[model samples]
Target: MFKEWARSVRYASKFHRKQEIVTFMRQIDDLEIYANLSKFLCDNYRQALKILKSEPELKRWMSVEGIDDYDTFHVWLEEEREYLMGMEDGLPKKREETVEMEYVKRLKNLESSQGRLSSILKAERAALSDRADFNPAPISQVACRHAVEHRNRDAELVQDLEVRLGITQQWTSESPEWILAEKSIMDHRYLDALDEIERIIVERLFEMTKIHQSGTRYKMRRHIAKALQARSKAIRNAIDRYNTVAEEMDPPKPTLSWEEVVNYGFLAEFDILRDTGDSIRSRPWTRRSYRVAMDRYFKILRAKEEIQRLNIEIKRVVTWIEDEDWFLRRKEAEYKDLNPPLAVQISRYRQRRARSDYNHMQRFWALAKTPGFTGSVVPGVSVERQQARHAERASRPQTSREMEMEVVDERERWNSSQEGEWEDDDDEGEEAEQEKVSTLMYQMSVLAVDQDDGRTHQLD
Candidate 1:
């Protein structure tokens, strides 16, 4: 109190005690600054009274901290008066005419800065505590409830945005992992806009993997499997497309040197066994390993029906040829035992056809599946992959909507705060509007009440 008394005495001394009074009206300069100062004072009056020494910890208490126009003389006056009331006429309202002129100046400033200040304007409503003949605007009880509803809704929206922002942070942290995983299968570069899509894809993959490992392995089993399969197919097809394009890219157009092939910008010209060792196809064990791998690959292929038919024909031919050799020798001496000569001739022709087919089949597969010629077509392989490729080629990348942007646009439209929008439209009563908990809740309640009230009023 003594310190405050001493400070006041000094402040009083700084001003001239003149008889003229000068009417000393410089325009308030910034009405926003005044409005802001009043709010800061009312908000932080108690904090200044209990000022602490630690600068960092006392930031909120000090005028330098948080958001408020600390430089404004009006704000400084307010901080003092807030904790110490009846402390003179308290930050005198600028002389009426000058205050009006300053307000006009600030009003004009709003035109260019409206978009920037939209959030600030809506947010400033919470700081209104001055009801002393300055009844800012007529806010009715019904309107107050609506304002509260709006505030609550806005709070929820802010909280949701905050949560999403946190999620975005977590997503950003894991983005490199997503980039790596996507690159593994996609062979594509990164896009900032695609962060959401990439995160979702990685998260989906993780979830699918999780589901596969979890006991939900049984509940909705088919649905989960289908989702996983769909994603896997998309990735595989994307890879296949990449490989196809890569193959058509001139096959690297290698400028092979006498000593080595140059790959990856480096001259790996010092391979010890480049020309000395047998190729994988010529080596016996290497040949066997390839055949084993090829068998597994073909079996896994779904549309191998045509290849299976060819295999059946080969098997039938081989079986017929084996028995016919013995049958023909036995029949040569036992012609009298034959039911019909025509039937016997037919049987002989079948045996000859079988022998010819077996040799023909061997030659076809010799080049195709042979170990040394592994670059050729896979023998007896199904056409499923070719069909799938055709199907994939028919589709293309599709566009999706930005739902967050859409939601924001909706909120902005509703939040426009038109001059008289809060006026009650209800013919029933303002009392009814005052009681709603949420707008969404209110809407539902209205419909429910209308239905119930209709029935009750008819009976009454």
Candidate 2:
């Protein structure tokens, strides 16, 4: 009966059928039957340990668990048995021992994979931040999101100017300055016309700023400043229209900052537009309009030449950013989806270690039952390994038949060799037999003549 149960347990453990093993054990009622099986299990445990002791990894495991001596090993066997029982009852405790280097290696690989993913995500974020077009501004200022809005407004103003220039609408009225500006643009005298407008605005602004005013002079200056402001606004509107069409046809592109281009030639004359908040000395609105017009003029000039180049640069940056964004997202997804194979490794190690521990327990119980059995009992031989070694030795080729086959194989191999001198005597047998007849004729001549006679005959 015990033999039958032992066979079932062996089959169950061998095939990883844990439930089946439990089912077989549960069918037993007799305490003696359990005892007998337990003894057998102990014997098997000792057998397995003896076989595994020679393996370096298993030896390291023994050292790690402090199972060096038989007494300590026996104590460990008891603990393992209880742990296995606990697993069968309800709660399964996972083995957290770092004894297996393979488990550690798997953990390291998972970390490395995740680390690479982090690097990709970080690079993508950096690329996103590097975009010059994505500017966010304060309550008082402009932002990147407003670029299209500003562009559209500029385009509409340009369209309005085009309608006025062509007199496309029946009810449209044209100002003389606007008409003159339009004619200059058509005639390709853009520089002359633009300069003339800029000169008129600048002269008026210079006069207003230079005026040293008492009460009457101040009043007169204020009136003149009001007229200058109105004129500057009208000229700026025309320039804005011209700039809009110029930008749409060939837009100006800036790689870093357009503020430099906008602020460059206007900085010194721009002080009049600064808000000093001093009511007594507040600069007129006309001065502000002139300054803005000057800035617009510079922007239009710069755009007329470099719009396409700036567009190409912006496109390149935006495209690179988009590519990086996609790559980063892909890496992030991979990271999120990362499921390390460490679980599988852990399962495998647990299965093997459980097998080893169970066998050790069975051996300890067997030793306990034996009369006068001491903890000093040590396995002198690994029966399973010895059998395996014998099996391996038996499978190897040997003796006369094998040697003859090897010789035939060698002959086949040697037949392909080009060098004649490397051939063995057996291989050169025909050549040696052919050379024997020539050697025999030479020997007969030597025997027929004395040493001196042979020498003299050879010389003649």
Question: TM-scores for all candidates?
Answer: 0.19, 0.15
Query: Would you list the C-alpha lDDT of every candidate in the order shown?
Result: 0.35, 0.40
- Candidate 2 weakest lDDT stretch, 10 residues: 372-381
For residues 262-336, could you state the per-residue lDDT of candidate 2 as single tens digits? 333432343422322222124222244433433343343444334334323333432332233223333433443
Model 2 scores a TM of: 0.15
**Model 1 vs truth, CA RMSD:** 49.4
Clashes of each: 0, 7
Residue 203, model 1, lDDT? 39
C-alpha lDDT of residue 321 in model 1 = 36
Off by over 4 Å in 2: 1-189, 212-216, 248-460
